[model samples]
Target: MTDTALTSEATHGVALSDVAADKVRSLLEQEGRDDLRLRVAVQPGGCSGLIYQLYFDERLLEGDATRDFDGVEVVVDPMSAPYLDGASIDFEDSIQKQGFTIDNPNASGSCACGDSFH
Candidate 1:
């Protein structure tokens, strides 16, 4: 595992692993878009009541907090910031699994499928 570094703004926000940032950069490059940012938000729903939403966003809403990992920018909304603070996002690529995974310290418990958290 590579050592993940957090920016001053990211210390109280989300941390993006180097691998994940690289992946995001590659994905954006493939799409040929430099205006989008990786948005991480928590929405109400799912088995555990709260589910994570990660996607590319071009619009920057009010009160959005951003952190840069390498050249990749990650944005978290004010409403979801508390739940995602201290969370680390990493990417894994292997025969067993392949995707971005969030490790949140704020989650008390998560669903069996690991898609949501309380």
Candidate 2:
């Protein structure tokens, strides 16, 4: 996977694995649109007080930091950058579980559902 930075001064806030990058690239290709980017953010109101949000976004908001894995772009907004910093994202397709997972070092605790963190 390519590790090229979008900008010299703009470093990636979070880590995106090769598997996750492939999955994201495939999904984006299926959508047939090159305008969308994979956005990762942390928001309030989960069982553990915070939850992760991952989706494709067409707009680039202010203070958005981006990193390119191959051709796929991963974005993190300013507010969510600190919360997601040093976090690694991966995709699993095993029979046991099928989805993207986040490994965050900053989380002190997480809920039972494994969907939120404190």
Q: Top TM-score: which candidate number?
A: 2
Cα lDDT, model 2, residue 36:
92
Per-prediction backbone clash count: 0, 0
Cα displacement (Å) at residue 95, model 2:
0.8
TM-score, predicted candidate 2 vs. hidden true structure: 0.90
Runs in model 2 deviating more than 4 A are 1-9
Query: lDDT of each model, Cα atoms only?
Result: 0.88, 0.88
Per-residue lDDT of candidate 1, residues 59-106 (tens digit): 766567788888898989888999998999999999999999999999
| TM accuracy, model 1 | 0.89
lDDT of candidate 2 over 1-118, digit per residue (tens): 1223333236566989999999998998899988999999999978999999999998776567888888888988878989999999999999899999999999999999899999
- CA RMSD of all predictions: 6.9, 4.6
